[model samples]
Target: MTFEKQVVLVSGAGRGLGAAIARAFIENGAQVVVNYRRSEAQAKALVEELGQRAVAIQADVSDPLEARRLVNDAAEAFGHHVTTVVNNALGDFSFNGDAREKIQTIGWDDFLGQMDVALHGSLNLIQAAAPAMEAAGWGRIINIGTNLFQNPVVPYHDYTAAKAALLSLTRTAAGDLGPSGITVNMVSGGLLRVTDASAATPEAIFELIAQSTPLRRVTTPAEFADAVLFFASPWSRAVTGQNLVVDGGLVRD
Candidate 1:
């Protein structure tokens, strides 16, 4: 239950679930590198609040070069190879059902955009961090995912498809990196109650979701983020290639 001395790199950690995850890791005694693509102000504020244990680095995980530089910069700044990576960066997206494009109307480009960020971005970070992780002989890679691919209550075609693909990569990466003591897993959550991305959702929709879920309330970023810590901690040393859903028992996987 302790990250003690572990250096964690949390992508898109400037705000929302990513920010909550970063804070949780820092609170648990890990030095965290908060990576952000455009949320520089928020990231800097988070780093300031977390003190010297945290540093904010700007990087678009979808770009291989930026991803490499991010890992390199984190190692240089922390004076240690990053021991844990949280691939939580997401492209521009919102949960407003009214605004989402229907499958028939959405072109391949829409799906590709999500893939570029969720799947390819994860691949980029994994590749950049692999060498250092291998050298250390112990590492954790946690991919943030969504339960929508399973339930698809709103049928967000592009977003769900992208996360589904990420799940595949999580398994494949785990298979390849297991021998090196590097475990890859996914933490999937249902519609989070509050996040910048989910802010546009209507209040009525939230109430409906809360009534249907077993917990009687939608999950929060902080609640869902705790699962990420379990994967990174020693308690899950033997766990890998698994997806843990954190959706107030809404969707059982």
Candidate 2:
């Protein structure tokens, strides 16, 4: 349950759920690599706030070359191989139901756009970090997923489909990397209370979702981040290829 010796990398750690995950790892004693694509100011601010234990690195994880560079730079910055990776980076998206693209209107490009960041991005990071992890005889790869594919609460076709594919990758990769001591898993969450991507969601929708969950509340980024910590911690060493839903019990499987 301790991360004192772990060097962790969290993609899109400049803000929202990614940032919260970075903070959680830092609090738990892990040296964190705050990976961001465009939020330079926010990322640097976070690194400064987290002090020496955290360093911000920019890379668009969908590209294999950039992804590899991110992993290499992270190790160089922290003087340790990255022992854990949180694939929380996301393509530009918003959670407005009314503004969503319906099945009839959504094009293939829409789905590809989301997949570029969710599925391909995760694959790139995993491939880049796996060798070091194998050499070290241990690694944790946690992919950020969505409850929408399971519940289809709002039927976000593009985003949900991409996450569903990511869940598949998690399982298959887990099986492939198991012998090398690298565990791959997923953490799926419902419409988070207020991430930049979820900000467009109306308050009424949030209230409705909260009322449906057993906890009678929307899950916060920090609360969901705690579950990510579990997957990265020693307690989950025996667990892999599993998807843990942290949406306040809205979608039970």
Candidate 3:
């Protein structure tokens, strides 16, 4: 579908990869909703920079009610139905390998928290937006995931586990929603070089990842954002229930 005919709601879009995804849609002529949980300033700043095609709305996707409201608000603002969603909001997290809790030290609650936001958040958005997508006869749902689940380079147990669950939801949702013309898919990336979550990563780790990948460099948020656009664009109309890894050939699955 052409972006000009779509309204996109991107969760946690105030910064990092989310921000890049939001901008990608906007540049392609889609009206975008930059949803944020607490980054109001950053979110609003992004909207301002993008002009009227984009607007920032604060809503935590973890709550089903709020997720619905976010979609409603986006529709009202743009005077258009929301035809796309990118579930990119993350529960508080950092990619600092040195500070991550190991298998022994981490508790179930830690894993639960990640699941609550990543898995549950994706469910809430899909449930809330599916009706409109069905009515419009077209829609796209993109879930942001990680390459670590497949490679476990650092074994960020909680984060990787949560994302693994999200990947499952993406495929299952595709089956359930395909009849309505809504395609569900995932775009997984490796340790992004400059996202806020990865800001604490040591320079040596970045160098190591670059050397390990065939591309000879870590993927940038902007580059990954382009892959997300493909899923949402007309180019991928026949695709669904698939996981496209965008980590510079680090993991071949």
Q: What is the C-alpha RMSD of each candidate to the true structure, in Å?
A: 1.0, 0.8, 0.7
TM-score of each model, in listed order: 0.98, 0.98, 0.99
Writing each residue's lDDT as its tens digit, candidate 1 over 49-76 gives 9999999999999999999999999999
What is the C-alpha lDDT profile of model 2 across 28-125, one tens digit per residue? 89999999999999999999999899999999999999999999999999888899999999999989989988888999998999999999999999
**N/CA/C clash count, model 2:** 0
Give the per-residue lDDT of model 3 (tens digit) for 132-217: 89988899999999988899978589999999999999999999999999999999999998999999999999999999999999
Pairs with steric clashes in candidate 1 = none
Q: In model 2, how large is the Cα lDDT of residue 83?
A: 92
lDDT value, candidate 1, whole model: 0.93
Task: Pull out the clashing pairs in model 2.
Answer: none
**Which runs of model 2 end up more than 4 angstroms from their true locations?**
none
Cα distance off (Å), candidate 1, residue 41:
0.7
| Model 2: lDDT to the true structure | 0.94
How many residue pairs clash in each candidate at the backbone level? 0, 0, 0
Stretches of candidate 1 above 4 Å error?
Answer: none
Lowest summed lDDT across 10 adjacent residues in model 3 is found at 147-156
Model 3 segments more than 4 A misplaced: none
